[model samples]
Target: MKIKFLLMIGLFTGSIIYAQDSLDTRPDRARIIGFSPAKNTKNVNGMLIKYYDEIDHEIKPKKVNGVGLGCNGLGIFFPALLLVSIPSIDNWAINDIGGEPLPDKMNKINGMQLSIINMEPTITNGLEVNVSSNISAPSVTNGVAVSPLYNFHHTTNGMAISTFANVSKKCRGIQISLFNVCKDSRGIQIGFWNENEKRKFPLINWNFKNKKS
Candidate 1:
């Protein structure tokens, strides 16, 4: 009984020491795969199922380098949708990539983002699949975004595909949807109604020249 008690005490002491050390380290350890609230200070390199809204781990910088499945955040960029309504001003002036400093949250996902409706003001460099809608404007998506309703973002360097609409401040690849809009486009827009800084067309629109749009 005395040996067992000693062993338990030793384990408790070790745990406290490790926790203290982790607070000072660059996240001494991480949760490889788990479902928890987004309050972890450690960076996640595997799958993370965020049950609650993402929060900033002010103690240290955090990132999710793998798959991220999140809700509770529909994005604070609803006003960016005004890019379509307000056509008089240049879209880049109000909201552009690197315009605002990123929040100290889980503001980046380097892999697949599975969103039932996830729209965080973060940069996503991989595939973003939204079951409903992804309205992460004034942010950036560097890969492909496949959505059912719409994909509205600040900048898309690859492709944006949606059934209803695809809107962006700047597009360098392609936008294919029922209604497509780009403030500055360097590629093609194929849809029923396409509009860019250059012109608006019915079937297709392309802007491959040096003209600034």
Candidate 2:
């Protein structure tokens, strides 16, 4: 009976080892596969021109500044999205490569380019900032450009601000704003890179309070 029990244990151990080996030998899941990350290069160009033309048309004696702010805001959002989505992409890359290490160049997303035309920020009470970034403007190659976000964080009076910009030559201006307000005995925190992982620090934190809203 003891010999039979030992044989069963050995078989179970062998099965577990084989299962682990099979998983190890499996191919990785896909993350990114293409020439570039942007969606439709030509369309991106068209969008840029369209945005620029609209802004130029809307330019008047009174709304010139407004046009600029609109452009800046557009610029900021594009990059923010890219940066925020990188981790997911990396995970896919790992899976696709079957746990094989990524190439030095492809390990981290790079070659991100951006151009901002007529970006202006309007600050209110030093705590709030209004901005615009042009997404489409004319490019050197006469095509539209797509930019990526790197890092940005701002805070005032316990309020926190995060920004993402989409700067391209064709549109000549567009941006997105992420504003976090903290008031009434509240506060805020900001983090970056690996700081957000490992349960360390949050990228952005805040508390809001009733004010002159």
**Per-prediction RMSD in angstroms?**
8.5, 23.3
* Candidate 1 lDDT by residue in tens digits, 1-213: 999999999999667645644454545355555344433345677765655443343323346789878654443244345434634323323233334444544357789877766545657899988754444324578999888667877778999998877878778999999888887789999998888878878889999976735
Cα distance off (Å), candidate 2, residue 73: 7.7
Model 1 has a clash total of: 0
Model 2 agreement with the true structure over 1-213: per-residue lDDT tens digits:
999999999999667645543444322321121112112211111112112222323321111111111233355565455556644312322112212221122111122223333221111121122222222221111112222232121212222223532111111111122311111213333433111111222344333333355
lDDT of each: 0.67, 0.25
Clash count list over all predictions: 0, 50
CA displacement after TM-score superposition, residue 86 of candidate 1 (Å): 15
Candidate 1: pairs in clash: none
lDDT of 2 at 93: 22
Q: 199 in model 2: Cα distance from truth in Å? A: 9.6
Best by lDDT: 1
Error of 1 at 14 (Å): 22
